[model samples]
Target: MARPKLPISATILVKNAQDTLQECLDSLQEFDEIILLDNGSSDDTLTIAREFNAIYGNLVIHTSEFIGFGALKNLAVSYARNDWILSIDSDEVLESTTLVRLKELFGTLDSKDLDSKTSESSALDSKNPKTPQTPTPPPNTLYALPRKNLYNGEWIKACGWYPDFVTRVFHKDYTRFNDNIVHESIMLPKDARLVRLDSGLKHYAYDNITHLLQKLQTYSSLWAEQNTHKSASPLKAIVRGGWSFVRNYFFKKGFLYGYKGFVISVCNALGVFFKYMKLYEATLPKKPRSCSLIITTYNQKERLALVLDSVRELAVLPTEVLIADDGSTEDTKALVESYARDFPCKLGHIWHEDRGFRLSAIRNAAIREAKGEYIIIIDGDMILHPFFVADHLAFATPKVFLQGSRVIVDSHTSESMLQARSEENAYKRVFTLGGLKARRCKILSHLVYATSRVDSKFFAQKDFIKGIRGCNMSFFKADCEAINGFNESFIGWGREDSEFVARFLFNGGALRRLKFAGIAYHIYHPENTRDMLESNHQIYLETIHTKAKFCRYGLKDL
Candidate 1:
């Protein structure tokens, strides 16, 4: 007589998985039954499933709206026809060797041994009446297999991607998937004998970088929604992002894959950052308002002209322009007035006497005179991208001040840009001779913007704060007023911005770092005098020591 077929069923949950579903089904031809639970798929996924069922007699297909991975997988398990169920995703393909091993393992299980195990499991379940009794497996049969994930046409052997052991093969009676919306795993009975098969499964996770980013966006949003009840700050997100990169790249030996490894590691960090950022945003109130661009200036009239020209090219213009003049020459005033005629929005200047390094004072004067509900502050020497204003507005949330970053243009590029003085030309040269960091920023701007983490931990780090320049920062007018604005007591340029940020945090305002979106090109110039560095540092220290949210010598004092 012919031997009875091994009682094994392969199950998968799918949604728009046309690309890999065929390969996955083909790989499981040896199984007694194939159970497919598909979420709503507008693509050719259902057609392919039907074709496979026609070709293979044991194929079973079910359609449902996705509830959660855990719940959906359990539903798939319930539809499985055989005693042993091998759970897999639509994107995964089991190896031929793994199939052989699974068959061999299942074939060895004696029916008498299974009956004894089931009796013992029932007795244990009776002893603990509070615990729900699941199906019991045979005496010695539970299986796990390593999964090799593919990304960007490459097998990522490191960065915590390899040897991804999943407990997929289990007796239908003894195990079920945990109820997690994402990253769901199988839950095994305490008494089930677990075994890891030498053969593995191939997981085609992402087709390319774009695919990875799309998933990152979707997954992060879902994670944030799920975690809305949990408390998360921007600082915690930053720390988690940074630590994720380090752990995956160095400790996980992701460096073995070269550039691809680095990219993967960075993407991993970004996932963490975006999740927390969304979570932080959920806590804030939403109120739309107009914005005023506050440009601080001293000298550099030529560069200031280019700055205004760039502002004119903005996709979304500020409601008004406030030039916070710190005792500049008549030439600077003339430049501002000249642009006022052609500038897209209302333009005005807040001029003060030529007192040395009185940026804090001039900014306060401008803030008091400003009419817009929001303020985007940048130095006159810093030229902005067309999307700068729009990006800030897109990410704007109440009770949060945005601290943005800039790409440093070397002195040569600065001169080149000054001579051209065109917004288009300035943006074109942002990648060339603008320095290594600038090129990197230009290439990965979107990723950087998506994952920029601003948390208290990053704020507290001195070296990290250096990247958080006032050259590109935005805040709500009300929030600025609450903190009494920039501390005019800060004599020089050094710690004025840092002190202000510290106070903002102390007042329960969260800081968000804008990486690529609110980018500015900082024109290189001679270093400012740091003679007041010691005094400024002392004042900043005092702010921290006293836990002072409002400075006595701020905008109001001025």
Candidate 2:
């Protein structure tokens, strides 16, 4: 048997909410009516809404002109017969516990004569049963309830997402929402009172990185438009954006939530960054390209630390830094967490469960979370030169991927190289660690960068993919996406990078060999075994044979 409907009318303003509409409507089953003000939905949202209307027989669908959030909400509330309006977003669902509380409140405020006060005189003299007491009506105009925000279905307690109090239940006759384009709120009268209701609203903030980035882009545009009169510049955006990351990741204890927390913090900072950068573009000169440095690491925190320390001394810093951790233990996470506190830009740790060698997968995961248009990838063991990032950005052009060489250093030399030690001893310690040739072109490095300075001094290796190291690579994010990221089929470390570049070349991408600059110091470590080399080589050969443009399993799979 169905329960009787409450006297409250719930309202929602929806646009392409097909993913969350059904759950949102189902939550309002106890209300007398549900109003859906749909602007222009091209998806099956209307179909879903009509299906619910057929079953419940309490839903009212209204097609209205596209307007601001507040205006559309006010118009929806006007058609309701009840004075009380329960405002909810398409992504928000009512909690069962919260529904019971709403029902109890609805019962209390059900009287039509709201002005009449009930008599409650408990104190009666011994023989004064005939005495009359003053009457006072219950205060019930606006109600604020707590909301819990979820990201990727995880309860994100930090990032200002928990205990989020929103005034949803309100008397339409007393208050209406403000007519702002975005971030609209209910306008309460000077004497209006509020009742705090039990929390039962679950806000599905984001489903994934793509979902988060898309929402941030849209909302930031609206935010920048709303504040067009404010002054903003590139420098201001960087400072504010960095500060936002620090505040959310550290001050708000977002680090306690792990990778999801780090990504959310980064996205939050990106939200502020896009709003200001959008402002700069609308008002000031064009902004520079934002670069993200992604470092891939295993469990080598010592080498990773050296790499990060060298990164801090770069001449041109990247917009942000992300560590693609491949099944590293807690130590790596701790190192990243500690360094993130003082990092010049936002530092995020993207980790995956250790399942042998899945370099391509981890890199793809980190790339998806990057907020920069250009990405520079390096191994965690490679200590960078001060001008490394600047060198990459020098030749960073569309449809081009730059593969740089590294100067391999033995363990003894690596320890002393960055310590202002003897160059003779360092050069003596630089020995070949494996069968491959060590790139120890120290004299050439000095003479080439010193004497004959050629403009864009890099060869365009159009069809060549051999001898290209993945340790130092830079490419536009769009170009990588066009190839659908690295081939995840090559589970082992042998030919993943080569196969990636081969696909890039076959897909009409230009490759360049960065020389004389963008140098990296590779810390000597025993080379990974060739256990899976034969299998990976077969995969690489197939890619070249077919001239594969995209991989079946890559970024989109994540």
Among all candidates shown, the one with the greatest TM-score: 1
Candidate 1 regions exceeding 4 Å error are 1-4, 108-141, 285-558
Count clashing residue pairs per candidate. 5, 0
Taking all chains together, the TM-score of candidate 1 against the true structure is 0.47
Candidate 2 C-alpha lDDT tens digits along 1-558: 456577788999989999999999999876889999999988989999999989888899898976777788899999888877889999999976566555555553334323332222122223323222212213345667778889999989897777688988888877899987678899878887665554559999899999999999998988787778999999999999999999989988789999999999999999999999998878752223899999999999877877888787789999999999999999999999999999988999999999999999999999999999899999998877778898888767666777778887766666665453223233223333322333434465445434422121122323334667889999899889999998889877698998887777767776667766787878878899889998998988777667787899999863
Which residues of candidate 2, in runs, are more than 4 Å off? Answer: 108-140, 284-558
Clashing pairs in 2: none
Q: What is the C-alpha lDDT of each candidate?
A: 0.79, 0.79
